[model samples]
Target chain A: MENKLKRKMLWLDAWDIEEQEAWFSHMSLQGWKLIGISKWMAEFEKCEPQKVNYRCDVFKLNDKSENNRIEFYKQSGWEHIATRGFIQVFRDMKGDNSLEIHTDPIEQAATLSILKQDITKRGILTLLLSVITLMLIVGAHQIDPVGNYLNDKFIETIVLIIAYMSISITMVNGMIHMSKLMKRLKSGSLLEHEKSYHRKIKRNKVVGITVIFILSLWVLTVFLNLMNSLQEDRFPAIPKTELPIVQMADFIDDFTYIDEEGLSYFKENSSFLVPRQYQLEQMVEVPGETWEDNSDIYSPSISSFGYEVRSEWLAKKFVQDLKEKHTYYAENYVKVPESKFDELWLSQGNFNAAFIARKHNKVYRVLYYGKGSIDEIIERALAKAER
Target chain B: MANDQRAPMTEAMYYVLLALYNPLHGYAVMDEVKKVSNGRIIMGPGTLYGILKRMQQENFIVLDELDGRRKIYHITENGREALKHEHQRLTCMVDDGKPLLGNGDSNGK
Candidate 1:
């Protein structure tokens, strides 16, 4: 068989497709006769460096010395590197094959290390970008009014809930899948073996974006609806026309408003009056009797009218009073009986105005009326003097 | 079975060397191994490339660069020596077992 000049082939760990092709061309240029090429599996199978059969293609070139061939493989960038498996050499036996030579393949334990080097930078960036996208979605939820809408309404709530679940799943799954891909890179597993994983990433992106967009839209819709509801309930627009609005709890007597414009004007004016009467009224209802007995003046006009009062102006006044010795309407002083002030503030719009008398000292006070009987107002005024 | 267990040559190494003993390229060698092993040992393409590189380094084989895609290889003198040693070791053990069995001829009647 040696004298017959049969095809000779070598298998090596670093022999990728392109290198092998280039090597083949180089040998052809050197006047080696081309023969039928076959794969080199038998030799690798016996070596079994990775506890599995090693398979490699063997290109048979005739009229080439074995020494020159090995040199060719090395010089052509097909040099043996440490690998998990082995490489083998073979000859075309034709009819009767003989075992001519064999050697253990190089221990390519470092291929995994090289492969990881190739992918680490890109892999980390991809993971980082994914995390940023997740953070943006979470940040969006915090800033927009969508969360409240999702909680309150039906369609939007359901959609947001589903979106939340989907996004969370996609984010978690994508990270897990990506981590697995990184592990494979570290392990020196072939890229071809991991090709099917790309589709999973794509699917996750699609699902995640869909979920985020839907949730964002749901949140936006809910915010708009809330604004509309508030506008409708609080200060709805009315055309100029004659309409009767009877006096309710806020008026001293049953007064009729014939003009819609006038009613709107009155309600707008009501906002202004709400603060004036209620501000000093709360100070009189101080929780402790000691402070009440010590003070001379008190007022509870806001509570008598039965209006739901808010004390934004009053709170501002207090702040201003703290800074300045006196505000525009009243002098600043640290009123005792803080708990009484809280109760009076909470129920100011419903308490009888006659009962509220501003007490400045132990024996001094000023009486005021807010939709109360004249007799009650006179009695409260006289009682203040007696105190 | 005990002797099999003591085998120095692994199945992958044995089969890969066997596959390359024929005139073949990377894919062709893989197919040959699969066929011979009845698909029990299917060599992936990447694995095949890795093995080809390692074998070429140890002087066990030499690459034939005449073909572009299929880089062929052949066994070397040193490779042959190792293969022969393995073969002789198995052969001697088989020969030693002959004494225990009646292998005179004619089906040992």
Candidate 2:
């Protein structure tokens, strides 16, 4: 085993078979014999700097036949150095002119097509899937912005989409190069010209590292934000009742009036994961506010839940859930789809009336029990959210 | 021409089969080709192995022997037939050019 070892980062496209072989040959002349290749990294065993011919081939094969291929190449004075995926790299100390596996340009092109074929087939499928996933995320944001905001899986989904797109672009780029090389071969271009990947390899390494750095920073920022939010009450208070989502309350036809004590206002701004949420729950002290309130008086109060959503998708989702859970049918439950806001008028249900509206980024979800129509109580709350 | 199905053979294929007629390993074939062509044609290991593998699979060549890491290959009857047909094609072109160029031309002036 050679004690001295070195590694190099490279981005070898499928058509780069010629370049990889040339680079390997050049490396051997500097006493570094390639020992292994894994994705972007190439490992070499250092030795006495000597002129040696090296070649890399790309082909699909099963393990059993691969053994035979390796054995055959070995028998031909070629030492198998490293294999990464479809690439097989070999080195030989034989005369520089005595190392080509395929002398015929036509044959060379045919063999190189193996990689092109694989990428063409699989790249299209992968590209299609990635595109579809991206479209789904866009649609999700449009359908319900609020739920999508609270969706903790957004970061992972975006990362996966980006990665898939990168892989897809690489595959497409490889295929394009393959076609160009094949065309040049068909039109009589020397194989030696495209054999030096020095500059390209350096550029690829920089790009690869830059992309990895950016992705790492993206994930790290989210993780750090989550950690910070978990450690401390991050967001500032929702500001003194400078404006409340719930202003006043009243009953419907029975003329149920407000308790005049002013609604009890409770404000909370909290965060879980990386997202922050502001919740404002105001209890309208009606004739029978709660089971205890009902025992004390006929004040049938409605507990309203409102949120200052961070995004449009989250706001949309909040409105959607409110409509699904609270809206009922028949005379007791009248659906008002044409209302200025998303409204449902009710006279006898658990929620006498439910009004869901979104102004800018803020969301208002009012479930009214004792109300003489949603306007009597929530008009001021709506005004506040609108403001 | 004999098979009618095999595409026109390339110079590399021709020399490879020609070199294998005497049973040679991949490196030897490369050297043999350069030697025969007077250093005009040089075959690399990648092209050498590719031709050998394809020829063997197509029955134009066969594994003659395996000595350690050197696998010696010999041209098969199919390889010989293919080479013979290529020879005929080249011969016709040479013969047809004989009258036009004047064999040993400078003397004709």
Candidate 3:
């Protein structure tokens, strides 16, 4: 008959040797005998339900005397089952008169020194990684706080911080627990092999499930946002419904919407920080208008971005960022005092004019490359923001 | 400095060195130690392995032969000298204790 096999995730830490031994023995009584072990899992084979004694020992890896050690244990009636890292598992019949792996507590403590050093090294590595992660997070925010918030990268940053913190905390907790176990062993106390592990197992299971759930949710949200962006139609006809943005029709009369390649489109997006955002780019030509009575057409263009932010403070910051960004190329932006909006700035270059305005929790920026007055465009934008 | 490092041998190390005097395999050494200590010192396989490895590193023991997976070991001259020193220290301790304890009789009680 074919052997039936089963696999189980190992939630216990490597230093929890006694708890592991007891758990393995309990599984054996339920007819599952351990056959293989790894860093994350244990594989078992079906067997008759019988009492068995399981033991775990730490041994140095890559030792030339490893085979001799195994042979000696075999001679002592204990069968070696598996090894994960420095920890080895062995078993024997419960009724058999087999000697324990470490009869002297002090000698057992000597064996644990290797594992203790390993944990200390891992703790240091975890700390280093955590510091790097924190620095990256802070640097991202410091570079461009408004851009980071607007692009919805703050969600990814928060998730990464939480994940790193969870892993670092777990590593530190494991290190401390291992140190306590070493101290007990050094004090000449024998490790108890039948201690109950149900409470710890249950608590770890809950925490593990919660972390997995949160990660899955984050992945799903990112995937859905990617799908939405990919499915957006480019250069579609202008909708008849009123939009929360300034359009070319609002400023020009009898202007025809240009439906050619790379000309006109509308995009809508929402994020946790800004619930509603709209972008519009349109190119229009006045009927029967030419630059110099030649084949060349006088096509004027406008690009407008509007955002309904979460709070008035964010709107103020968004408008300030917009003004700062345009000031680099358009020279100094002059504030339009006593405007209809709460705050406004007008920037003009040789051929193009732009304005950024904010009122309450709404902010909008418009760039017009046409033969139109900048004050007129600002009036239309304020009208849209008021609605 | 070397003498200081090798002066105080643990009980497990002393027993293991004594058992290796006859060029015994790993299991045989453990059995010999238990027999010599009269069931008072039960050396676990892990303890014995660690001691053997350390002693070999210190040049206190040498591998005599290899029979498949079984390795036979023998104590070296350095091992003998260290064991003799440890025995003398133990004897001194016992002599000092005997004067006060009265030869392990009911003197303290």
Leading candidate by TM-score: 3
The residue pairs that clash in candidate 3, if any, are none
Question: Candidate 2's C-alpha lDDT?
Answer: 0.64
Order of the predicted models by TM-score, top scorer first? 3, 2, 1
What order do you get sorting by lDDT, best first?
3, 2, 1
lDDT of 3 by residue, A194-294 (tens): 88988777877787777788888889988997897788776555687777798887877777877677788888877788889888888888887765545
> What DockQ does predicted model 3 obtain?
0.67
Best by lDDT: 3
When summed lDDT is taken over every stretch of 10 residues in candidate 1 chain A, the lowest stretch is: A45-54
lDDT of 2 at B70: 61
The candidate with the higher TM-score, 2 or 3, is: 3
lDDT (tens digit, per residue) of candidate 1 on A191-236: 2311232344356457656777877787787687678667753433
Query: Where does the lowest 10-residue lDDT sum fall in candidate 2 chain A?
Result: A247-256
Residue B91 CA displacement from its true place in model 1, Å: 11
Pitting candidate 1 against candidate 3, the one with the higher lDDT is 3
Error of 2 at A194 (Å): 7.1
True contacts kept of each: 0.00, 0.61, 0.68
